[model samples]
Target: MKTFISSLLLLFSFNTFAAPKSELWSYWNVSNEKNATTISHQYWQQTLDKYLITRGEFTLFDYAHVTDADERTLNSYLRQMSRIDPREYKKSEQYAYWVNLYNALTVKLILMDYPIESITKLGGLFSFGPWDEEIITVAGKALTLNDIEHRILRPIWNDPRTHYAVNCASLGCPNLQPKAFTARNSDKLLDKAATEFINSDKGVLIKEENVQLSSIYDWFAIDFGSQQQLFEHLKKYRPELKPFKGDIRYDYNWKLNQQ
Candidate 1:
């Protein structure tokens, strides 16, 4: 019975029931001029600086250490983010807004049930992750973490680096950036994030005839295009990765990314 249940959970985790495609919600595909306005992520930045702890390659959030005051501050930041309409801003600002909002909400969700073992354990027996749960309403459109990541960011930006920027609150996922993203620093942060994750063990590790890769590549294979394209993407960040064609495997860790 235990083995059967474990197999079921694995299938659920690996897109048997959760295949989110990069389909744009046309309502949010609009954007204003590049310099039309500026949005500040200072509160989010402050929150990250206070809570993120770097342990080697993994930067964990101090979920256990968050204070009432800090939680209030985070809630306030989230409320402020929800009030604004991102489509009125330029694509760069919108990019930062969506990424920050997704991450902040994820943190908030974790705190709501802290001390949990993994994010996949949320929502009960059949729950794989809280990704599809409707958490907030923006512009009168109810949204989920999946909505933000797959529908808005991925389709609009059409950048594979979107995977690197929007963290999934898991150890195998890319780092929850220590600094909040902004129009001014989004590009640089995205580049740095891509470089870091791709070179790490979670991204790509080649050992003789066997190669292991993060499930991000497998899940979003369309984003990276093809096997050859993925190799180029990995090689762009980690030049030491030599060309190889051999046994390949994909894995992900779903443990809560906390200290």
Candidate 2:
């Protein structure tokens, strides 16, 4: 009787606690190996490459609606992430979680269908749909983007770089970094992203006399420390932009970041 009871308990445990489909992060590992420049770019290139090679559509995976990704695979990845102990997770995981949630949610949105407009268009109850609050089991806790951002990321770490990492799936937002986020590499990745975006024409374009920048700067100026500090950071990469004296302006495109 004891043996049978023990076996039954073990079987029940496995059934109840067996790894789900949302905890695996291996995709990011495969993605990182494909590009050396930065984890952010590697992530983008890998997804794009895979989609282009197999599906012949770069924008197909842009929404969480119509992605070809196996939901079982994604759910498994999320499940593993959920199992990570909060204490064991380093401070950098805060940033990593933000990035992960953003990417995962973005992918989830794209998987639904080829959305023609902005993700915000899914707004409802508050402004966004269930995707906004939809919970995914992570680190043994079921959490939504709101819980990840507000309860975990924002509360644990207050770095301004976070603003750059949580992309809104729009052109005006910072390009989503493409690598699996880690504590050791997050700072470098964030710094690199900020610098690249500020210098990129798509981010902050300084065209001789006319300067056009991402509205992110205007929306989250507080996160960048100050306007001067933000510009200084940008100048570190593009010295040419430093001397350009022109009207500083922001341009925001609501178009979805799909190709």
Whose lDDT is greatest here?
1
Q: Please identify model 2 stretches exceeding 4 Å from their true place.
A: 1-49, 52-69, 125-132, 137-142, 243-246
Error of 2 at 205 (Å): 1.4
Backbone clashes, each candidate:
0, 43
TM-score of each: 0.94, 0.65
Per-residue C-alpha lDDT of model 1 across residues 106-140, encoded as one tens digit per residue: 99999998889888876656677888899988887
lDDT of each residue in 173-250, candidate 2, tens digit only: 666665556656788888877766666666777675787877766655655656678777667756765644568787
RMSD (Cα, Å) for all candidates, in order, is: 1.9, 15.3
Q: Tell me the spans in candidate 1 whose CA falls farther than 4 Å from its real position.
A: 1-17
Candidate 2's displacement at residue 211, Å, is: 2.0
lDDT assessment of candidate 2:
0.55
